[model samples]
Target: MNKQEIGTFLLRVMLGFTFLMHGLSKFQGGLGNISGWFQSIGIPGFMAYVVGTIELVGGIALIFGLGTRIISVLLIFIMAGAILYVKLPAGFMGNGEGTGFELDLVLMIIALHLGLNGSSFLSIDSKLPNRKRGQVSDKMAS
Candidate 1:
């Protein structure tokens, strides 16, 4: 495909894979432990499971380019929440004492780009009949 298409595909794959791993790690480490951590941070403990499941499912959808815009938006919310609640106070460098929002912000930007652009290439959205070969597609709108 073209460079832009390849780039978008790569971004989708990377974001999906990263989140998939994170979700898997949370499961492997025990949901209770993750829930406890969330509770400690003032978030409801049950939200840990909900967020983990969403990340896992959303990551798969992203890799396959299914519901890309919606998935991107959901993932964006997760990243934004992370930045606002956990990382923003730590500053840019992360300094070992606490993590920083820099990574979360980068992920949020990528998610926002995908949300606005839709799944440009190598995606199920593009393969659907509603999307024309050369037209600008708002997959969700269609």
Candidate 2:
């Protein structure tokens, strides 16, 4: 692979692993606790389940380069929600209350990049016939 492809591959894998760990942690540490925390934050408790499932499934798809752009878009939305609802009030340094949106912002930007530029040729999406890079279809030229 070329230099750019290698970089994209690394980004895809790292981002995937990050989300996967976060999702897996909720289940490992206790989904009920996470759900309770969500409720405390004004988000519906049941959303914890939906978020966790999306993170887990999306992470796997990202790691394998199955649907990098689509997964990235979903993850981007999740990070945006996190920044808006959960991290904005905390400020840059957490201000002693909680962590801020810095990390979330970074994740959101990376997801955005992945969504726009897509994964490298090393991904499963690239292996498919007619599909190029992270594309799901080849109706038009890249």
Candidate 3:
């Protein structure tokens, strides 16, 4: 693969893994704590479940390169909400540090990248059959 393709692959891999970990963490008591924290910050507790589900599902979709653009968009919203509701009040230091916006910022950037570029050539998305007839030429089919 060329440099650009390699870079895209690496970015997808890193973002996929990072998002997956964050989502997995939610199933293991992290979601409850985060939900409580959100409630403490005037956000509803139920929203935590919604966020957790999105992260988990979106992360998995990203890793598998399925519906990448849609998942990326959803994650973008999730990260944006996190920045607004959580990081904003903390003054970017992230709750007591210097602009705790680090994770949110990175996630937002990655999500935006995925939204724009979409899954790389190596992804399952590219390999999937085209829904539109006549789109796949005979040579490509062979």
Tens-digit lDDT string for candidate 1 (1-142)? 7888789889998898888888888888999999999999999999899889878888888998988899899999999888877887788768688988888888889999899988658788778777556777676558
TM-score quality measure for candidate 3: 0.79
lDDT of 2 at 124: 92
**TM-scores, all models, native as reference:** 0.86, 0.86, 0.79
TM-score of 1: 0.86
Q: For candidate 2, lDDT tens digit of each residue in 1-142?
A: 6898888888888899999988998889788999999999899999899889878888888999998999999999899889888888888658687887888888888889899999866789988776457775645654
Q: Name the candidate that leads on lDDT.
A: 2
For all predictions, the C-alpha RMSD in Å is: 5.1, 4.6, 4.3
lDDT of each: 0.86, 0.87, 0.79
Model 1 Cα shift for residue 24 (angstroms): 0.7
